[model samples]
Structures are given as C-alpha cells and as structure tokens.
Target: MPLLRTNTADKFIVDRRKTHRNSDVSRAVKHTRDRLSQRSGSPAFDRELLKLHARAIVTGASAIPLLVLVIAAAGLLGGMGGTILSWALVTVTCYTGIALFARSIDKADTARIELAATKRNFLILHSLSGLCWAYLASLGCGECQVEQFPVIKAVVLLLAMAATAIIASSLRGALVATFAAPVIVYGVVGARYWMPVEATMIGLLAISLPFFAYVAGHLNRSALMLLSFRREKDGLIAELETAKSMSDEARRRAEEANLAKSRFLASMSHELRTPLNAILGFSEVMSNEVLGQIQNTTYKEYARDIHDSGRHLLDLINEILDLSRIEAGRYQLNEEPVSLLDVVEECCHLMELRARNKDLRIVQQFEASLPRLFADERAIRQIALNLISNAVKFTPAGGEIVVKVGWTAGGGQYVSVADDGPGIPPDEIPVVLSAFGQGSIAIKSAEQGTGLGLPIVQGLLAMHGGEFQLNSKLREGTEAIAIFPRGRVMEDMPALPTLPLRAVASGGRRR
Candidate 1:
C-alpha cells in the first residue's frame, strides 16, 4: 500500500507540473498579443518602449534590500527567522540577476536583435521578476503575534505594486504582470486571515489597481503621441533637405548654360562684326553713289534704308554684348572724378536732335552747387544717355521731356529724366526691369527698342553703389531717377596750396 501510494503521488506531481507549464505558456502568448496589438510604427520605437520598462525593472530591484531592512528592524519574522532570511536572500539574488539582465539589454548592440525578439526577452524577464515579488507576498507572517506586522507586510507589497505601475506604465504587459502577481498573493493572504482590518486593507489595495492601470494606459498613449510627432518632424526635415539639394543643382546648371552663352558670343565677336561692317560700308557706298551714280531714285532710297537698318542691328549687337559682359563680371570700369552736370548736359544735347525731330521740347534743370561724382566716366555717360533717349522716344509729339541734375537731401547727387508719355503699369514694373522685357507702351510706340536699357542701367548703378527707381502713372507721365549714395559723393575738399612747398622754401632761403 505504501509503494502504491508513493507511485500515485509521483504521477500526480508530474501532472501538476505539466499543467503549470501549459498555463504559463498560454499566459505568455496572451501577454505578447495584447502588447503587440497597440504597436506604433517603427521597430526603433518598440525597442525604446521596451528599454523604458527594463529600466523600471532595474529600478524596482532596490526595493528588495529595503524590505529586508524593514523586516529586520520590526522583527516581523521573529527576529529574521532562518527561513525568512533565506527567502529574502533568494529574492535578492533573483532580483540581482534580473537587474543584470536588464542592464545587458540596455548595453547590447540593438542592430543584431530582431524587434519581436527584443520585446519577448524583456517581457520574459519582467514576468520572472513579478513571480519573485509574488513569492515574497505569499510568505505569511503566521508566527508573529502582533497584528500590525501583517500591515507592514501589506504596506511593502502595495509599495512594490505602486512602483511597477508608475515606472513600467508605458508598456501595459509589463505593468500588469509586475503588479498583478503581488496583488493576487496579497488577496490570498488577506482571505486566509479573514479579519475586518485585513479585509478592509485588501479592498483598498484592489480598488487602487484599476486607477493605476488607467494611469498606465494614459501614459502609454502620451508616449506614443510624442514618438509620432518626432517621426513627422524628422520626415519634414529630410524632405526640406532633399528639396534644397535639387534647387542647388538646378541653379548650378543654369549658371553653366549662361557662362557657355557668354563665351560663345565673345568668341564670335570678330565673325559677326566683319559681316556687319561689309553691309554698312556697301550700303553707304551705294546710297552716296561713291563709285557710280544710280539712275533709279528708288534704288538710292532703298540703299539708305539698308544702311540705317544695318547700323541699328550693329548697335543692338553691341548693347547685348556689353550687358552680357556686365552679367559675366568681366566688365571693368574706368573710374575717375567726373562732372555729373557735364555728363547730363552732353547726353541731353545728343538726344535733343531726336526730341526736336519728334516735335518734343527738351527742358534742363541743374543744381548749381552740385558736387563732382567719383565714378566711371563712360558708365555715367551711358546712364544719362539711356535715360534721355528713352524719355525722348516715349514722349508724345509736342510734349516736354525734362532732364534734371541735383543734390539729394543726404548730400548725394541724382539725375532724373521725366517724360510726358504713356506710363508703365505698376504690375509690369518687374517685367520691364528684366532683360529683353518690353512694356505695353514701348511695344505699341513707333520708337520701340531692344528693352535692354533699364536692366543695363540697373546693373551699372549697382556697380557704382547707387540705385535706379522708376515712378509712373498710366496716361500721365514717367519719371526715371538714378541716385548716387552719400558714400560716393565728394563732401570734404583738400585745401589748395598758394605756392609749392619747395618754391616757398627757396624764396625764404634767398631772402
């Protein structure tokens, strides 16, 4: 009978062990599913989430030593009984192992591990820690006569649960496992005692569980939101970087194309000029009858027309080349102290004949006390000529074209050309300022030009530390002002010497 009983007991123990293992496996599968269902994007995010809980596990390990000290001080286990001390030591050793495992996860190369495996390992370690804490709770204070000793034990259990809920809250599975095990053990001990105070304490602990779980859920959501926002910010920054890279490449290509165009024009300069010279010379000879008189009068008129057309085309080519050189940074200015008044007067005189031919009057206004401008003489003359020419060309027959040179309020000088012509529209100002972009009035007028004038003026003034402004109103008039900045204006004058220093010295010596 004894041998039969022994065999039966062995079979029962084996069955119980198999049942426990199966239950653990089922619980683990359920835990993994619950945790993964709320997974956010990115494997890196999951790794970070798991690492946070792992840190909590390590942090909670500190509670074991504190519990041992508390039990020793209070004599809760009858002056630290051998069984209780051994259990405490076992708990401490297990927790230390858990803490080291967590540290390894933190220090391990994240690149080598799969995301799913990392989470599984962390969860496994956490569940094992919860089991250890649960075992501590199950160590009933049955030997203690003091009723308050159970309360102390209860307090320690609840404190451990609270720590887990607060720290590992970002991962729900870890939070639930770490706290639930201790809670169940506490309930079992409370039921065995069946005292009013113990029941009341157990009820309070149970009620606190749901509240902490809710807090855990809320914390998890907040962390997920923050991670999402970080991902979005990173994506936006990457997109902006890519767009900037593309823009820089396009700009580089555009500059290369422009440079090639400039080089081609510079190389073909002689070829273009040779044919133009032949056209002009041959047309002039035919028109003048230098070799022989043309019998037909119509042929002589056509020859004159050809000569004029050739000269206009040649002038257009020269203007294009000059503007190209300026844009290419190859145009060198011959700087000097130039009389602004003289340059304006000469340009006005040159354009006066054109104004008179179109039945327009030229009006000049000069400030007598204007100072000399330190600038490129050729550039200043070109600036004045272009303005005066545009004013004369656009002004209506019998209209007045006013040219003014004066001192600015800031001790600088200015040249303005105002014409009584159809003005440019405000919206078209940018269009007119661009290269080869003509205005509506210019296109309709008989004196339409290549539209390079304003851009050239703007470029030239930029080189001189000056600015060009155009003010106009439809059907009223147009005024173009070129302003030289105060820095370029010669304000302080050097005192003139009555005689050379050497001459004065020689005269003094002779005396």
Candidate 2:
C-alpha cells in the first residue's frame, strides 16, 4: 500500500509539473482558430463561398496579359517556336494557383492554407516577371509596336510589383529578390529607352532596403511576444483550476470528519451520563439514608450494582482519555515486573460472573513454568480486562470463553483470549482492531456495543513493550492475542513487583 501510494504521488508530481510547463486551453483554441481562418482565398474573404470561385477566375484571367508578354519575350529570345511552351508553363502555374484558391471554399484546407505561403512566394516571382515585362516592353518587340508604353507603363508596373512584394512577405530572401524591379525600371527609363526618371526611382528603392528589414524585425519580435504571453496565461488558468479542485476536496473531507466526530461525541455523552447519573444521585441518597436504605438485603445489591456501573463508565472514559493522550503524543508508560498468568487469571475471574449471567462459562489455562514479563502492570491488566469482557459481551448463552498464558522459549510471554461465538468476517479482520469498528458478524449477532473494546485492548498493549493481535473467522470463533517481551526486551523497565488483584480499581473484580 505504501509503495503504491508513493508511485501514485510521484506520477501526480510529474503530471503537475507538465501542467505548469504546457500551455493548456487558450493556446489550443487559438491554434484551432488559426487553422480554420488561414484557409479561404485572398487572406481576406468576406463571403468565402462566392468570392473564392470568382477570385480564382479573375486571377487566372489576369495572368494572361503577363503570360502573353512573357511568350513574346521568349519568341524574341528562343527565336519563335518557344512561345507555345512559355504559354503552356504560364497556363499550368496559373491553373495551380486557381486550384489552391478554389479548394479553400469547400472546407477548411490545412494543406491549402500552407499554399497561402506559396502565394506569398509568388509575389517575389511576380516582381521578377514584372522586370521581364519592363525589359520586353522597352524594346519595340514584335507583338507590341508601342515604344511609349515601355518607358511609362513598364517602369510603373515594375515598381508596383516590387512594392506589392514588400507588403506581402517579410522573408529577407524573397523581399530582396524584388531588387530586380529597380534595375529593370532603370534600363527602361534610361537614355536608349531614354528618361532621367529611372535614376531617381533606383535611388528610392535603395533607401527602402533598410526600412524593409527594420519593419520585418519589429513585427517578428511582436509576434513572438504575443505567443509567449498566450502560453503563460493558459498555464496560469490551468493551475488556478487545479488549486480550486484541491481546496474543494479538502473542505469536503473535513466536513465529513466533523460530522462523524459530532455523532461520536453525542453517543459517548449519552452513554457516559446514563451510569454517572445513577452513581451521583443514588450514592448521595444511600449515604444519607434518604430512602431509609440499608435495611433490606436487596438494597445493598442495588447500591453495589449502581456503583459498579458507574465505575465501568469511568474506566471507559479513562480509556478514551488515554487514546486522546496517545494521539497527542503525551501518554507515558511506567514499567514494572508483571506476570502474564496473574493478569489472565484475574480477567477470567471477573468475566466469569458476567459470563454466568448469560449462562456462559469462563476458563483459564496457565503454564506453571511461565516466565515473568516486564511490562506496565496497570496497562496490561486493562488489556486483559478489555479482551475478556468483549468476549463475554459478544458470546451467546452456554458459550465458552477461555484465557490462556504461556511463555516463548525465546523469553516472551503470550496471553490469549478466545471465545466460541459468531466470529468476525474475512473482510473486516483488520477493521476489528481499529477504533470504533466492529466486524460484520459481531454487529449481525450482537445488539449493543460501543465498538471500542478491542481498540482499548490494543492501546493498553502498546503502552507496554508488547503488541496485540486478533485472528478470527466468520461464524467460527475469535482469538485475541497479546505478546509481551520479558527481561532484556523491556524499555523503561522499573524494578517493581507485579500489581496484585487488590490493587486494581473497584470496577474490575478479581477472584
């Protein structure tokens, strides 16, 4: 049980550590939202369904103007036949982008959302394509005879494409690729295609390089900070919830213990008062002869019975007080030389009278050669009395109760009380020794009991340098054993003779 408890505790600590280390709720929710929102076209889709398809058709149609120019450039470069191949490559690339955009409308596409990064990448590629457009348009090419469109339109398109790329992505490699645009614009607006505007445009794009880097670095740090705060807040919320649950469980356990304690206090008070009330009032009455007592023979017997009941209640209270002291670590033992046989004989004799009332017999067996055990005399006597009394209390009419004493060859004495009665059940064997516990068979057959008899015996045994053990079987019998160590085994062993029968309190009798 201890090992299992330790393993469970270790696992809980490991799990709790993970709970603090990991981001739990909000991060997971945010990630899921990112997955859902990243899909659907344009990175800005108001009505994802209608605009998704319309955007695809529009982007595909728009690619044809650039594709036609690229093919015209290829015809000039590869000498006529390569136009068809260039158009086919442009068609394929356009259709692929269209397919990705179209896929985002049907359902959330995690793969297609990643393809949005491809779209970002295409911006740099488009910037390079714009540089080509500017170069080809600058020449009086076969397809377009308009030379004015190259200087004005081509340079404008190249700068716009480069600026579009800077807005789309922060990746240094891709953004730097847009530098091709300024070079192409410089050539188109220069003297052959002749304009002074291209030099000023190159100077502006050169200044924008450091500006782009500064902006990208700032946004990256900001995004990293946001993610870190999200993880911290999520962990804190999980910890707070765990602490709340622990507090609730502790409060619930305390409430249950309090209820049980209240019931116990009430029961003990009622039980103790019943005998004490008679002892206080009647002892006073009999002493004063208020009822003209001491005349009839029955009067003496009644007084004796009341006195005995009160003393019995006092003994019970003392046992309870002793248990409280032990729990508080305040109980101390006074050691003396005690005979196991003498205490056993006395408990048997006291129980004999009680047992006879139920038509039960009490028996005692002692070894003549039994060695004396060093123990606390008062505590040992109480242990014997508690065990024998419980046996007599639970046994049926005509049942036999026996007390036995013997010595171990290894220098210990054993005292045992056995009864022929309905014994404890298997399930409740350990519980039979606990405070305020009784076995299933004991409760089933007996009417009234406080369930503290064996517990008192156990406490008294512990006070000595001894131990008490209980062994029982259902419907068979029970054997309660107390084993004491003699001589060298005793701690705090004071030199004193065994406590005689006369020295016991008036509650317990000795023959």
Candidate 3:
C-alpha cells in the first residue's frame, strides 16, 4: 500500500515547503509588536528620561554661576562686599561641580547607568546646592542703609526657584530638592525680626517653592510622554523595515524558483517528447496493424489504449509548457489582423465533433460584419477552444452549449462560451482558473483533464492586454468570456487617392 496517493503527495510537498518560512516570519512580527507595546515606566523608558534630565542640566549649567556673580555685584553697593564676594565664590564652585557631574552623565552610555543610584546622587548634589543658597538667604545688611535689602533677597530666591523648575523638569522631585532648604532657612531668619515686611517675604518664599515644584512635576510628565512617542515611532519604523525585508526575500525566492522550474521544463520538453513520439507512432501502427496483422483481439485493444493514453499525456505536457512560458513572460505573440468572428467560429467547429460524440448541442451566435482584431491568432484560438471544450466536456447528454462572438460593452470584441450543465459552485471559480487546479465537478466527472486549460487561456489573454471572466452558479450553468480591449480592434482605413493614367505616365517619363 502506498503511504500517499498522487494528489495527496503533491499537496503535502507544497505545504511542507511553505509552512516553516511563513511561521518564522509571523513569529518575528508578533515578537516585535509585543516588545514595542511595553508601558512607559519600563527600564528602557526610565533610561531615556534620565538621559533627558542629564542633558537639561548640562544646558543650563552657566545660568546659576552668572546669577551668583550679579547678586555679588549688587551686594557691593550695600557695603557688604567682602561677605557677598566670599559667598559668591563658594556658590559658583558648587554650581561648577554639579555642572561637571551632569556633563559626565550626559556623555556616558545610558545602559551603563543604574537608574536608582543615579537619581540618588543627583538629589544629594541638588540638596548641597540648596544649603549654599540657604546661607545666602540668611545674610542681612542692616547697617548699610539698603532699606529694600530683605525684598531684594526674597526676589533673588524666587528667580532661582523658577530657573531650577524649568531646567530640572525632566527629573521628578529635582526642583523641590534644590529649593526646599532655602525656603525654610529664609522663613526662619525673617521670623526673628517679626516685622510685617519680613513676615510677607517669608510667606512668599514658602508659597513659591511648592508652586515651582508643581510646575516641575507637570513638565516631567510631559517629558515622559514625549519620550514614549519617540520610542513608539522608532519601533514602528523598525517593524516596517523588517516587513519590507521579508517581503523582498520572499519575492526574490519566488522569482528564483520560477526560473528554475522554467529551465527544468525547457530542458525536459525535448527529452520527454522524443520518447513520447516514438511510443505514439508505434502504438498507432500496432493498433492499425500497419506492418502486420494482429492475432489476438486483446492485443489490438491494448495497442489502442496505449495510443490514446500517449496522446493525452502529450497534450498535458504541451499545455503545461505553454502555461509555463506564458507565466515566465517568454511566450512571444505572433500578432496579425485576425477576424474575431472567424477565429471563434473555427474553434466551435473543431469542438463540434466532441460535442456530437457526447450527444451535446453546440450553438453559435456570432454578430454580422464584426471588425478584425489585432492580436495573436494562436492565443485567440486557444482562448476560444478552451472555453468551448470545457462546455462540451461538462455538458450532459441533450444539453446545449452556446458559443457567442460579438462586441463588448467597452467597444471591443468578445468571445463567450456558456453551457447548460451541472454548473460550478461560485466559490470554486478561482480554483478553476488557477494552474493545475480543478473544480469539484471536473474532478468527479468522467472527463480527464490536466486542469491547465483555463489558466493558459487567462495568461494568453493577459499577454494580449485582454481579460477573461468566468461566471457560474450551481445547477444553473457556467459562462466564460474572453474580452479584447478596444485598442486591439482594427479600424477601417481611408481609401487611397487614385491618379489619372496621363499623370502616371508623365511621372514615369520624368523619372
């Protein structure tokens, strides 16, 4: 017993060839999609946020040192020059250290940085800077006759808080870490004086710190949202590139496989046909007793069977080669002006004998005086023959097959073959049109076919810039139409002008 029947073996081979490659591609796409769908707080996203924070700090590094210098210059007018200058040097040095640390972080690879440890170090540095500012806020100039000195100090702190909020927005809690101590210290020193102006300045400092921190939190959320968008965009681009590469590979492989198949068929055609021709000729001669008389009746029947089967196999091979050449774009058309009505009529006549043998009626309906079509005569004949032959093969005894040749609605020529037979199911039309694909009716029927007829017809029509349509319904009938475009319809040319005999003679004498 065979493990696989012929058709089953063919199907198994095709599926096995396709399954592994298709599954691998689908798995890769699914993995990419899942990886990209991770939430915003994933480690990758956190690293991106840290990198943004480091960059922001480096960008605004000079602002703090400049502000300290300006404050120190203002303090000289209040006769507290030495105290302010000394404080300025300390503040500037602290800010320079913080800036250097931030720059180092920005230049280093994000993958090497530990997020928790980096955040902790940044907060510690910011708290130290806060202490330096707190000391400045506590200083006073009572003997210098600068009446608005307390207000000036409060205004400077407010400016510093606002700047910190903007610069450190990407890192959560950074603004609060840098300004919380300063606000507390300023409020404490003002409480000692207990004057109305001092109380007001302290109240403003306390209120402004939380306000700036709230703004910084909002800015941090915005930064995270922006980073998420950037990450998603990059993921989408990567997915597209992967899909494109897979598509290109599949197409290239398909082209190579097609080329290999074409070459095998081209080389094997001659080899196969040589033996088939000898078999067919010998079988026919033996069946007819051309050389000698046969003794047994069984021998004669076997010879006839060999001839018939050989003929069928040869036809199948020819059909396969024709379809293959058409698919590979190697089938060149021998084009000419051919009559649509005449070509279709000839095809109907050729199939009429088979129709008669099956007890089926073939009716021809051709339009009168149809224009000639500029097309490959052989291709057009094959189209008509395929359709008509299918009709004859499938139509039951006493059924009718109509072969119509006429004008299409698009001002083009068309050949339509319709049969009153057990029709194809609508869903199976596509299968019937595919190469080596047979419909259920064709498979179950006694008629033998290689299932290359309709596909070859379609490919040939396509080469001629035409279209083939199959319309069928179960238990109703089937109709196959081959339509030639209006461009292929040859128009009548104007008559050439006739010259008088005298003018012709004068031209000949001049020559």
Quantify all predictions' global Cα lDDT against the true fold.
0.76, 0.58, 0.84
lDDT of 2 by residue, 380-483 (tens): 78778888888887788889988888765446677778898898775565566666677776777764566667766666665665566677766778788776
Whole-model lDDT, model 1: 0.76
lDDT of 2 at 285: 76
- The numbered model that scores best in lDDT is 3
Estimate, for each residue in 1-511, the C-alpha lDDT of model 3 and write its tens digit. 0011111122111434454557866886687667666655788877788889889889999898899999999888768969999999988888888888888889989899888888888888888889889999899896688877888899999999999999989888888888888888888888898789988999888888888889988888898878767867887788789889988999999989988998899889999999999999999999999999999989999999999999999999999899878877889999999998888888888988998899988888888788789999988998888888888878889899988888877788888888988888855666777778888977887398888898888888789898777777788888888888999999999899999999999999999
Model 2 bad stretches (over 4 Å): 1-315, 370-372, 407-412, 439-448, 462-466, 485-511
Question: What ranking of all candidate models by TM-score puts the best one first?
Answer: 3, 1, 2
Q: Write the per-residue lDDT of candidate 1 for residues 251-356, one digit (tens) a residue.
A: 9999899978977897777778899899999999999999999999999999999999989888788889988888878889998788899989998888888888
Residue 86 in model 3: shift from native, Å?
Answer: 3.0
For TM-score, the strongest prediction is 3
Mark the 10 consecutive residues where model 3 has the least summed lDDT.
1-10
The CA lDDT at 53 in model 2 is: 28
Candidate 3: clashing pairs of residues:
none
The alpha-carbon lDDT assigned to residue 464 of candidate 3 equals 87
